[model samples]
Target: MMNEIDLTKVDLEKPFMAGLMDGMPGGFFVYRGDETKKIIYANQKLLDIFDCDTWDEFVELTGGTFIGMVYARDRMIVHDYVRRARESGRTSGVTNYRIHTKKGVFKYVQNYANFVNDYVEGGLVYVFIAAARSTHDRLTGLPSMLNFLD
Candidate 1:
């Protein structure tokens, strides 16, 4: 029989969780699930993705908010999508959008988010972000071979 670990007893700020987040390939972050959507935590990879050298710089660039991290043109659509998904009782979903980095370059990113109720924060969204690579040919707009293998 497998022993089930109790999440309620786990401390998220512990080294194990911190190390895991830091070692992850892509970016990971957590934000409040409120109108402000204030950022609570961000891994180093996330700072790199935003072309920021430190957490302070990242916060300054993004105004410490999730919506601020998104490209202005894509914010409304992304927000609507998340709201709709949550309203439909979905706990997690993926959103493809663009982000205006601190370097002023817009990069397409795929954001995977999980909506959960936290014991301390009430509502929170844990997110993983990665560069969005096209699985289709740009010119012909056809699916690539990698798509078929999946």
Candidate 2:
């Protein structure tokens, strides 16, 4: 088996990290672990998923926490998961939740976040890969029976 990676020892540059993250199958973003958890980097796919044409727009729209986009009922789940992961020193975890899109609609989203620290000048950062694959009615945003099949 491969040895566990020491996250503190990884020294990846932003350019290299971006190149790797951009090719991921879904949206990708990095956010600092501060009071706001400010967005530090967002890949092109993430911008498209958020209906943002540019990074600046995404930053302005999210107001630092992507948690703002989550459905109110599901927001706590995200927070709890993050808290648990941080406590356990986990490198990654998957969270499923709903997000309110800019088009005034909601989409079920799955987020895979990897925790990293000191990757840059920031303290702690989370790199998230997210995908929207809700088995809901495209029009109503309500879960269909088919959602169970997924």
> CA lDDT, every prediction?
0.90, 0.72
Model 2 accuracy (lDDT, Cα): 0.72
Which residues of candidate 1, in runs, are more than 4 Å off?
1-10, 134-150
- Please give, for residues 1-104, the per-residue lDDT of candidate 2 as tens digits: 99996767665674656677778778877777766777777788877777878777766666657676567888898899889988998878887887765565
Which candidate comes out best when scored by lDDT? 1
Local accuracy of candidate 1 as per-residue lDDT tens digits, 58-87:
999999999999989889999899989988
Candidate 2's C-alpha runs over 4 A off are: 1-20, 119-122, 135-150
TM-score of 2: 0.70
TM-score of each: 0.81, 0.70
> Where does candidate 2 clash, by residue pair?
none
| lDDT, residue 5, model 2 | 62
